[model samples]
Target: MSNSIATWMGKGHAAVEAPIGDDGFCFGSEPSLADVCLIPQLYAARRFEVPLDACPRILRVEELAGRHEVFGSAHPSVQPDAE
Candidate 1:
């Protein structure tokens, strides 16, 4: 990968491993901004083959979001304009 690409992916990896709940945001409730961002990011991470096992909070949030009806609403396949 190019230096820029490596740097970018490195940043993402850092984000995935960073501590959660460190900013006083409640994750026990409905998903927050971090949860929202992490979903698509993890999707990309999987496609890009980035190691995410270190990001426990993201996996937990994703697993929780995956279990609920609310997550379905945000699915691209279910979008009103989706193909």
Candidate 2:
């Protein structure tokens, strides 16, 4: 499980490292559908204790998304019915 998480996150890290954009997001300055999808997976990764020390780009995207008004409000933990 740990190896699988590392492999996937490594792939994600490489994708984000490309010349996608100057902004610290999965694609560009603005959050897109990719960001929407990636954020939850990142949340799950953290929940599962997946080490992210090497995935700086993924972490950066997660951080940027966290500050976005839409993403911030939509986070699962912030939902009205959340435990």
Candidate 3:
């Protein structure tokens, strides 16, 4: 499981290292479907204790998304039922 997680995160890291723009999103300056999907996957990765030290671009995207009003509001941690 750890190996698989590392492999996938490594792939994601490589993919985003160059393409991620100054806005820190997966695609463009504004959040899009890719961001919506990426954010949740990042959340899940954190929950599962997946190490993200090498995925700086992914982390940057997550941070920027968390600051967006819509995305911030929709975070699982902010839900009423969250523990």
Candidate 4:
């Protein structure tokens, strides 16, 4: 599972390289479906302890997303159902 998640995130990291631009989110200036999907995958990767040292773009995305209220508040650590 860890290897799979790492590979998937690596692909995602490559995909966002050119398109992410200065705004940070995957499509245009605001968060889109791509960002929405990417955020959760990142959470899953972290939860599973998948190393992300090589996926700088993904790490950047995760960092920026972590600052958004809508996204930040939904993190597993802060969620009401989290254990």
Most accurate candidate by TM-score: 3
Query: What is the TM-score ranking, best to worst?
Result: 3, 2, 4, 1
> Model 3's lDDT to the true fold?
0.79
**Candidate 4 off by > 4 Å:** 1-19
Off by over 4 Å in 1: 1-7, 22-26, 77-83
lDDT of 2 at 39: 86
Task: Name the lDDT value of residue 68 in candidate 1.
Answer: 68
If scored against the real structure, what TM-score would every candidate get? 0.63, 0.74, 0.75, 0.71
**Can you list the residue pairs that collide in candidate 3?**
none
**lDDT string, candidate 1, 1-83, tens digits:** 35565457658767655666533222546667767776777666665666666666666667777776877688666888976
24: Cα error in model 4, Å: 1.5
Model 2 ranges off by over 4 Å: 1-22
Clashes of each: 0, 0, 0, 0
RMSD of each: 4.0, 2.6, 2.3, 2.5
Query: Which lDDT tens digits does candidate 4 get at residues 1-83?
Result: 56887777667666666566655776665777888888887777677777678666667777878888999887778888889
Per-candidate Cα lDDT values, in order, are: 0.64, 0.76, 0.79, 0.74
